[model samples]
Target: MGERVLIALGGNAMTAADGSASPDDQRRAVEGAMRHVTALITAGHQVTLTHGNGPQVGNLLLKNQIAADVVPPVPLDWCGAQTQATIGALVLNALEGRAAVVVTRTLVDPGDPAFQDPVKPIGRYFTEEQAGHFEKLGQTWRRFDRGWRRVVASPEPLEILDAPAVEALVAAGFTVVAAGGGGVPVARDDAGRLVGVEAVIDKDLAAAMLARAVNATVLVIATDVPQAVVGFGTADARPIGSITAAELRVLQAAGHFAGGSMGPKVEAVLRFVEQGGDRAVITSLEDIGAAVNGAAGTVVHR
Candidate 1:
């Protein structure tokens, strides 16, 4: 039987690690992902897609810096909106005009703690001296295994404004792509109008919000791993299959997942299932079909 599935494509889905992240490269990557998506559609399922634009948005920030003297840099929210359209175009191209993309805006709390303390790492890595250079310009930097890098706020997604449009598209049997880069983080002013913020929202968290808003039964978080694993990169690393939400939370609290990556995926899935979702699966794009059937990936249930 067909089902409604909301798919969250990880950052790696749009760009290859080895290949140059050119427009051509992105189109090729999207085409391959679309093949997997089309497979689900052909089997009579309704699909909606959301993607992370970390790398692409970072590239835009870099370009803005390079041409700042000649052109005013774009705001973070605007950069996010621009990437949504650009990535959407690439996805639409891959879909061969069969899908529709909605440029969405997400609401966040104006007093969200994330804004008070930005912790989302972004852009390319930098050496200590380079970090110092950025620090002089009032940019926040943090040390990592590679080097220092800029960090920004990853606010919680309160609502996805265009979610109805996405759901309507899926209802009409068309695949819809929305919530690119967390839907250009925004908040309501005292006057109750939408105002763009200068920060990036976590894509996984935003995906969960979209899933909830659209009332999707299954939330599929597609990434580079076929299944969520514990002791990742260690000799005793183990794959997680089906697990209850409570068990997953215990595992997460034990420090089993890294904050920047897998941690958010686990958090997203937990939020979905806890909030009445039937199930949420985390797996690689190639294993999507199997994941939906409970034959692959790590499934989190109520």
Candidate 2:
């Protein structure tokens, strides 16, 4: 039997330099993404996919806000769920019947601390003046070079609601795409009915949870970088090729990874490995094949 792998795709894998989210542009990105995934499939790996929707969800939120006067704006959680379905459909279409895209939902604890402090940034950038306007309206803001944008809480994922469906697809020899935008954060009501919450769940953390749920042996997180780096930008910056989970945790404790970027990736890896996953690799989408073969990227082990 071939090894089963769960691939967590980063936003850049589907994003373009021009930031255009047109279907054609996304198709092009998906084409590039499939090349890496296809290589693994051809090499006899049973693959399941998950992806980020930071940019897409942000755009959805902006559209909702703009159309609010005529139609009430949807909440962020619903917007995230919508992006997951939209992007998952795009991925399924791109696969040309080779894979199945499941509109997945993930369950989170209603009491998660993130709800108290929505800190994850989403949507389009704006000028300082424009940001100030939103800020005055009581929206949380984060400033970037282009301007500022509203950020929302990104809680950790507890369970992927569609895991059984994903596993069924994988067992039936189909590639699965689920947990987009961290599976659209949801929590169970007192009656045990799933209800959407107003938070984004970190996609990487959700991916790790999905991997565990599916009993995948390998977890590959495809990011923009070819390898995980230490001391990211300075002259002493170094690339991490391979490391044990314990060592990675030590480095994490020392703050070698930035919270907004590399930190989540590293944390995901450690979690997966600790959960008995064979290995987790962090590498660029283009280098996925090489990374799997140990020719490139950072590989974390138990």
Candidate 3:
């Protein structure tokens, strides 16, 4: 029997290093990644997909800024929603319309501590002077390996608002594409109305929550690396094959993973396992087939 699997697609798999992927480019890239997904479906695993939107949303943000004089700029949440449609279309097409793209929304707490301390970076890199200019305009910018980029509050996801829709689709035997860009982070108002917020929710964390919501047995996070590593970017770096949640937690606490990059991924893997998921795999797209079969990648268990 096949297990229900939730795969979180990394932004690196869709966009280029410099973050300039046109729709045609993204379509080609998504098609390449979907071949792996197609293989999984062929093997009988029911699949649900979620994807990161940092690059896509960033491109939209840049466009908004460049044309600010001609048009009003869209909010962060709107940008997120737009990418959900854009990428969702690409994935849906690659699946030959055999899948459903749910325009999902993620419920978040308005008071999440992350709001006060924005750290999730998005958009294209800017020079020190350009970053300073944006800072003066009230946007926060942070220095990263590439350059300074815009950072937004990354609140923890409380629930996936459209998870039921995704579940129904999957239960009906449809491969579901959902929670794109963490489902456009939203919160409830005093009147219990859904209100979009100016924040980005970490897609991996959201995927874990969605996995638990939909009762998925397997969670796969596809990234640039074949497996999670300790001492990353160092000569002493090592690839972690199979690790228990407790052991991975120790390495995480010791700061082997950088908060900006691999930390959230490892955290998501632990979150899924500790929260009752049977297993989770962190692997690259090239190895997804083997990873699902337990022949490759870092497998995490309780």
Candidate 4:
């Protein structure tokens, strides 16, 4: 039997060098990602796929805002859920019998500290005038380049609502994609009914929760970069190949990773290792197989 692996794909899995958001562009990107996934399947690994949707979700939000006059714009959470289903469906179709996507949801605590500070960014970039208009409407906005965008809170995932379903699908010999865009950021009410919230969940954190729930032996995170680097872009920069969970924690405490970038990836791997995962790999989509086989990328262990 193949080892069960959960692969968390980053934004570059969909975005290209030109930063186009068209369907053709994204499909091309996924073709490259699928090659890596197919290689893993051929190498005898039962894979469960998860992906970040920062670029896609931002495009969705922008479209929603532009069409709001003709159609009621969906809330952020609902838009997120819709993107999960959209991207997942396309990926499943592309897999052509290799994998199936489960439009999954994850549960969050209603009182997570993140709710007090909405910081996860979303939507297309806007000019200063456009940002000023949104500010007048009471939307939280931030500047990127000379433009601006709205941001939201990203809380920790408490549970994966569709983990059982995903496990069953894997047992039936199918690759599964779940928890896209951090599983739609929903929380349960007092009556136990699931309700969507106005927040996003970090994809890496959600991947960790899903990895734990499914008991995946390996957790591989595919990013644009091949390896995690320290001191990022200076003469002292170093590429990390392997490290213990303890060493990762110390580096994190020393602020070696940026919060909006590599920090969450390292943090998620540490959590997975600490919670009994055998190994974790951080690599780009093209190097996924090599990373798993220990020839490339950074590996983290307990």
lDDT for each residue of candidate 3 in 1-302, tens digit (9 for 90 to 100) = 88899999998778765555888778888999999999999999889999988778878989976776588768889998889998988888888947989989999998899989988777888899888876776788999999998898989899999999899998999999899877888998899899999899889999999999999998999998899998988999999998999999999999998887898999999999999999899999888888877678999988
Kindly list the per-residue Cα lDDT of model 2 for residues 45-126, writing each as its tens digit: 8889999988787777788657755786677777877787788777877667578888888888888888788877778887
Query: Which candidate's TM-score is highest?
Result: 4
Residue 297 lDDT (model 1): 95
What do the candidate models score in CA lDDT, each in turn?
0.88, 0.84, 0.88, 0.84
Weakest ten-residue segment in model 1 by summed lDDT: 16-25
Question: Which stretches in model 3 have alpha-carbon errors above 4 Å?
Answer: 16-19, 127-138, 142-148
TM-score of candidate 2 to 2 decimals: 0.92
Candidate 4: tens digits of C-alpha lDDT, residues 1-302: 66789999988887776778688888888777888898889889888999988788888778876775578667788877878887887787768775778888888899899888887777778887877766675578888775787877788888899999988888899899999978977888889898988888888988988998888998998898998988887899899988898987887898889998999999888999999999898888888887776677889987
User: What TM-score does candidate 1 reach?
Assistant: 0.93
TM-score of each: 0.93, 0.92, 0.93, 0.94
* Tens-digit lDDT string for candidate 1 (21-96): 7887888888898899889888877889999998788899888766765887677899899999999998888877
Off by over 4 Å in 4: 132-138, 143-145
Ordered from best to worst TM-score, the candidate numbers read 4, 3, 1, 2
What would you estimate as the lDDT of candidate 1? 0.88
